[model samples]
Target: MYKSLLVTGVCAGLLAGPAFAQPYGYDDGNDRPEYARVIRTQPVYQSVRVDEPRQECWDEPVSYADPRYQNNVTAGGLIGAIAGGVIGNQFGGGAGRVAATALGAVVGANVGAGAAAANTPYVAHEGYEQRCRVVPNSHVEDRVIGYDVTYRYGGRSYTTRLPYDPGDHIAVDVDVQPRAY
Candidate 1:
């Protein structure tokens, strides 16, 4: 009888040891998996203000005249004076010719200067300049960061925010714990 009682006790202990050593929630009957009906799922959005930098470019026309042609004015006046004096020397006699030559030289110098200014070559340099500025193009965008889920579980309504949509039903963890009064 003592040997039989020892065998029965050993068998009972072996069965109970596994039940006690099991993990807290698995098959322990207190914690299990259940589903909650999703009543409404509203997408939670975040207002994001984005600033995108873009390069906007356009061509601007630029032009300038070369300054090397300015020396022609003096050369033109001297040439005109010599031509005028020769023409005047052929006109009058003696002192009159001298007076005429002086007047003609003066008139020729003035005319030559004027002609040189008008005939100067204007070297125009035409080109385009690319100018740019950083413009802040901003716009507000609504991004769905999460979902506001309203669900009914065990005849009670609860609201929670989830990172993804749970469709019509959401799997929930049901943990039953003794109330501490």
Candidate 2:
């Protein structure tokens, strides 16, 4: 009877061994680390626009002319007529001298008026003014944002995006579990 009991106990222990090895809802922290072969790699890029501020400057010409002396000739005409009448009195005889003096005064007044108009000096001012403006220079550039990696593990292919290049091989975590069905 004792031998039969021992045999039954051994059979029960054997049946329960698999159940204790893998509990239904427990983790033993037994994830295995393995390597996966890299199938292909491609670089991912992003387009970005950059704006830089710059100052643009140029010189503009400015000029001004005085308007006070533009059209006044009264003083010069009166002075010229008086001088012409004296010179004409010295040039001809009695009656002829009087006629010559009148003619000379008229001619001199006209000449003096024209001379005053032509000789008036105009006051001019010349200078430059500096003008400036701010302009934005913009340009577009392509930047590498990340890398797309394709790898093969356990006869299956997978693709993932990573921040850096994972050379020829990548480390993978493997965990074994029983199916729920």
- All models, RMSD in angstroms: 11.2, 14.6
Model 2 TM-score relative to the real fold: 0.43
* Candidate 2 lDDT for residue 80: 71
Clashes of 1: 0
Query: In model 2, which runs have C-alpha deviations exceeding 4 angstroms?
Result: 1-33, 62-131
Give the number of the best model, judged by lDDT. 1
Residue range 57-140, candidate 1, lDDT tens digits: 888999866655556877788988988888888888999999999988988888887899889976778989998877779899
lDDT of 2: 0.82
**Which ten contiguous residues of candidate 1 have the minimum total lDDT?**
22-31
TM-score against truth, every candidate: 0.49, 0.43
> Per-residue error at 13 for model 1, in Å?
21
